[model samples]
Target: MIQRHEKQIERIHKWKEDHATLLKRIRKIYIWVIWLMLPVAIFFWLFLPLSRNTVMIWFWSYYALWQVWIISRSKTVMWTHVARFFAAGIWLVGPLCAGLLWSIHYLLADGAASIQEPWSAIILGPIVEEIFKLLPLLLFLFVTGKERQLSLTDYALFGFALGTGFQFMEEVLRSWVSSRESLLGMFISLIYDNTKEWGFAELFPGYFIHGDVIAAGHHVWTGFAALGIGFAVHFRQKLGKWIWLVPLFLLSWAIFDHGAYNSHVNLLTSDIIIEFLHFFTGYGHWYKWLFVLSLFLAVYLDYRTLNQEKKALPLLPHETLLEPVTESIELIKSILQSPKQWAATMLFLRERRAYGFAMALKEREKPRQKIYHHVQLAYHLLGISALLLLSFLAVNSIAVENPYYLAGLFDGLSAWWESLSAFEQISIILTTTLVTALLMLATGGGIISAGFTAIGTGLLAKDTLANSEQIASILRDPKSFFKQLQEDAKEMPPQELMMKLFGLGLDFASRRIPGGKEGIEWLSNLQSKSQQFGKKAKMDGDRGGGGREGNEGTGNIPKKTVTSNKGKTIDVTPTANHSTTTSVPNPAKGTPNSSVDILDKKTGEIKTRRFYGPDGRAVRDVDYTNHGNAKTHPEWPHEHIFKWNSDGTFNR
Candidate 1:
């Protein structure tokens, strides 16, 4: 029965794995489809009136969002929350609050003029709009029950989305009424026009517009409040019972800023605040700078919190034996060299963050099924909405164009159609439809393949680039390079160092070396002679059998046994004064014996160590002698990595 139960559990686990694999495949296909459709949608949107304004807004908003995404260590924000909150801001919060405020104004005051009444715009409007803008996010937190799991950036992003959506709706309405040639043009004018003595300029300061009307306008206010909420939740332990006050204070401040702007009232005494800000910043926008400063502080706090959290989590498999500082430096170098590498590196970091989050969630006994479900639903909704929007725009563009032009084109086509028989017309229509569908499929497949190829090439290029410098150095001076390699071999495993050296030699030989192929032949012959000499010396000493003194003269090494992480014991032998060789017993049958070598050097009181792998192949190498004041004091270690090829050569 126990065996049966174990078998059943195994089957269940296998099924889950299969399900996960299928879901991953589906998600990839969905992402590819989205990418393919995005260009088409943008093309359609461009044909619509005021589309440039919408595009510009999206560009700036996403740019800011990207910055937030970068600053965040752990990406905890769900796409579902982003889409839902933004949509709610557009369809629910914006319209509902605006309509409610209008009703209140109509009841209290007279006509269109009452819309700008002090009670409405100055006090009530700010209070209503600010609270309503946050309602969707509050509801999201309550419904999802992810209040504790969320990062500060997640909250800020949600707030930014909500505010951006609300502002989008407001701007659309204003643009429709104002008879503006382009909203983008008007925005540019507001920024550049210093001569226009507009009352709205006082609210934003520096910019000749109202704060809430500009791009990232309402985003700044709402994001500030959301950040406070994030801080309060994250630091609940430190704040004790007063945690609620943090968000409340920030929310009140947002409302006050809105109200003050609307009323044209200066809360600060005289121009003291303005003058102080001007003296320091050379700009009189104290409010703007304060908000900016708060965002920076929030990012710093989030980074610190993430670092603290990471300390408790187990290291990733790749990170276990590798030095993180060294790995990061290599990653940065690769990123700088290639744009593809930059993208791949970012994706890798994102995956690592996801893994970290998964581990953290597991430790907390939290189920992520709901989050996954939400993400899928959001993606589907977004995909459907985008398709519908694009379809509508395509139709609308044609419909809104000059009827005569379209009619003339249609008449010509109609005449051509009339010239053909019914059978020919049917055949042509079918062929055109089939061809168009095939072209689209071909284009999409090509795009998806290209993306994958680019990613793979980027990773491959990074490895190639790793050895390029060393190969270049070897080409310049093989003798000096070989001498350095000999010194490194003393500290590193013999097999690993030899594989690296062999690989570098092959690369050097392939390049335009000083002595060409003859030089390589000479080097190979020299290595063979050295090996023969060592073997002869060993045989002579063994034949004499003169005990320890004879063994020492013959270079007989002293061996010590040490246990590996796998709980297997391996013999470590010092073959030379500077080098020690560690023999690793192969776990699998029919495999060659694997060994590692470590070289240690002592100078006066300071010691330097280099570690290598059991197979004499190193994924990374670190040198500690160069870091800090190594001559006077022991320095922090640095690493060098090499990729081992199946053909007994180092790839890097």
Candidate 2:
């Protein structure tokens, strides 16, 4: 009897498990279906006037591209799909609120504002609209006990939906209250619009405002509210607690953004700057922009809170991606020698930067940065590998006719917008281009300045290279950039040191010499006291090629050696003349040891490249023996370790 009962129970459990699995799959399909039908919503809402040919073709093409993108294997593409729909759904609520606004405006205000009642349309409109929007959000906060997973972008969307609804109602009433002539004008326009449904601007007569404008406003107000709420919620969330009072400031910001927007009709302040901001952040009027900006702020807060929460959690060693750690030196040798430890150090530094920025931005803030961190790097590697594999198959070019369609459509729309007479497009493009050029110049200049430093350091190395490795090693150091200057420093003319370090000997210290700042800072810093530690430029006449026999004489020295983000290799470049032309005796000779940890160059180094590996670590060049000072590690990979060289050999 007992065995029979147990068997029955087991059978029931198995049935339930199977049923649950089936339900999950069904839900997934249902979600996909809803996601796929989004283009219909877009068409229905856009309400633009265009030829059927243009409308249908554009819509179909757009729909297909969106479909392919969402279903793509890339998580970046998939998440974007979800976000767009979320934005759309957010806008749909506008129609309903707009209906309410129409009822209020006509039933209460009767018709256009009288000469003495300008404030009625301005003040009343915002009051009613704001109530509609904020009430729902406040209600959610009150009932949910805590809104933990909510982001600033979500708030922006919510605000947008509220504004949209208000706009719809307001427009309906505006149309209803219109004169017969205007009504006739609208009807005739509708006929024309239906014939040429190109974009989403044809439904103005029957609606409050365009969906784009409406969505933008809603997004702004909500975004603003989110900023305040975000700040309030940040610390509470980090502590794993909740407080209803957190969103009060957010609510106030919404009020201000909306109230101010409604109050202003000024052309310069209201129409231009306000309108510009509204459009920039996806709002109808500039008044709404503060709200969207707020949303961006909220996103920032949300990420900060989440990061803090993550940090507060107790760490365990289970080999995970979300969290990782390197081994410690509790019972082991030195920390620097341990490969596992260095790996962890590099990983932490890389992750902090990537995820740090990831959570800081809202849903649509330039995804490429995050993509680079989480996936694009891998994709690039895969792309290269695939190229190599395809070459073996003798394929010259490959094109996947999937995601490019949407990109092309976007290109067209952007082009059309660019061609428009509106000042909005012109200002945006001009400002963007100027900013981009400036950034490019800054970055390019930074690189060139750095290059000059390396060359100067190499010059300094001319005298410093007791052996060839000093010259060769400089090329491999993180300071390889500065090493360029130091590379031949030891061999440079005495005058070159003044030229490189101070731009002049003791006479010229602070005269803002063109590229002298970099060379001076790097080499001069190398000197602890007042001693100048730079190289005087060595002319061809000052060449020092004392090919002294290396301690471990130059025998079969590998052509080139490449090191990556901490000796790890991402790629290996050819050694062909890349190494220093100089060589010297190894430690086997009397060459004094003068190596320092200056080459531990990579900071927040995420990925590493690989170069050619030669026979087991040989005395590739001279022996470096400078026991320089090391900085204390606050964000170290793990607990530190020590591995003293009992002999000259230790695990590198």
Candidate 3:
């Protein structure tokens, strides 16, 4: 049995190595593709007479990317990983799930018309779409082998990508179906047809109302579900066996929200609730408010989780320390004075973030090895591929009867190209070549030399050019830059610096905009209130014995107080023997709210840990000291678990 276990571990390790290699190669290829496609995307954006639908698509796409960027600013996950997942949502999950939905409707419904009927849209649609949208997240967790290492923000980002992709595809299909255009015609219309009929209402459907569009959408819904999944996985051990139900509950809630929107059912039936939502959202979009609220709550939870996780991460070497304002100023200076340095600085920052995340992951507890069968992986891949192929065929079969054929469209284009005079063709080629070359050079060269050449000839701002050389010097040496950043951080209080920057921004805005001074005053009051609230919360936490002390004991171990769910405080103190013991405030008869953590003397590694509930039962117990007892515990470093009852009690 031991030999078999060893073999399994060996296989798991081998698979992980191979998977890492494959991912690295894929990342390299993706980077190349992004660079190569940049010019093409720009050319199309500039020259194409985009239809209303296409414009809306571009708008939503930009909005989604912007949201991802803003939310992931302080996150541990790499943007590239999120981008790959986003692409998957667009190209893979979106089409495959869509095809599946089409197939289901065709199989069950009376005809093509029945697919959009009330019953299907209200009931069947929500279940199928929600489940399919979640599949990518589940698959990602299974395949990555670093599920435990992932943060809540990471899961949310993945879900957002999937949801965005699905939404885009849905909008495209709606346009195609409504217009009764041929596949080829639909493609052409997306680029060449200039139609003004499609407005914000048509693009977003039920979301736009009262001259405003709610930020909540399909991405928000999926992100909420994904955050629940993250919570369930992260707290499974601490929260007991019942914690796994969180994801299911969230998923069900998402389905209900989707169904309610489709059926035009107002879940918020109370007048008070309706009034509150309308006043805040500036519209009577109850479903959108519910989704937005849920997403916001989930984000708040993610932020809390991030606070805890960040404490475990070591500070990165040579990390940029400039405040947001200073950083922006430096970036602008780099772009204007030296584009090459700007490019290098950007690359350096990207690498630095990636390295920080890598270090954090390395510091985490070693994960349990799981044997992943190649056959099982192959089956999953084949199943997904088959579904995609079948869906494509099914959708194509439905569209084939349309009048606008792709063959004739391509033929016309070919003929047009052939008929062009040599001079015209040369001009066209030269224009395209020049545009592409200029774009490549501008982006590649760190700064557009032509644009700078023009700007350099004119009067430049003295303030902007004041520290140009200094910025250039720092950009050249990342180590020096980071070292200076650390010094700056040490010299100035972060809050003070933040306040100074905010004041500068407010002053600048007040001078330029109407009622800006009043807005600034209101914002200041809000900030003051928020700070007071934060201070109160911290004080409460400390009073309740939920805060850790900074004072270090022997071997740099810190004494801390932990507050349990039952309002019990447990004081933990490190001993001379390298073991820590938790002392409960008071014992109720036989019940004890105590715990013990045995640590290795040399490495300070946890050898064994045990936690007792208020009911005197062992709620959780980890045994790394008994790995030799394979008969009892086949898995090394396994924990003895207790089930949590619905009424806040544990069942052993």
How much is 205 displaced in model 3, in angstroms? 11
Candidate 3: stretches off by over 4 Å? 1-52, 72-74, 111-113, 176-216, 265-312, 315-652
lDDT of 3 by residue, 338-453 (tens): 43334333433332333334433444434434213322443354345434423322211111111111111221344455665675455445433333233222212211222111
**lDDT, candidates in the order shown:** 0.44, 0.31, 0.44
Q: Which of candidates 1 and 3 is the stronger one according to TM-score?
A: 3
TM-score of each: 0.43, 0.29, 0.44
Of the candidates shown, which would achieve the greatest TM-score relative to the real structure? 3
Off by over 4 Å in 1: 1-49, 70-75, 78-84, 106-113, 180-216, 265-284, 314-344, 351-652
Which residue pairs clash in candidate 3? 339-446
Ranking by lDDT: 3, 1, 2
Cα lDDT over the full model 1: 0.44
Local accuracy of candidate 2 as per-residue lDDT tens digits, 1-652: 3345546755764464457667556644533443344344334325522212223432332332233222211111112222333223224344444455555555775432221132332333343444445555544434442233344444444434333333332322222222222465466545522121223433211111332333223334443444344344434433432332345434433443443333232122333444554445445344344543444444344333333332221121211112111112110111222222223333322323233233333222333333223223332433443343223222111121111011111212434454545543433343333222221111111211111122222222222222334333544674764766655443332233433444212112222245544544443333322111111211111212211112222222122233321343222221211122122313232222111111212111112221212322222222121122135322211111222255755332
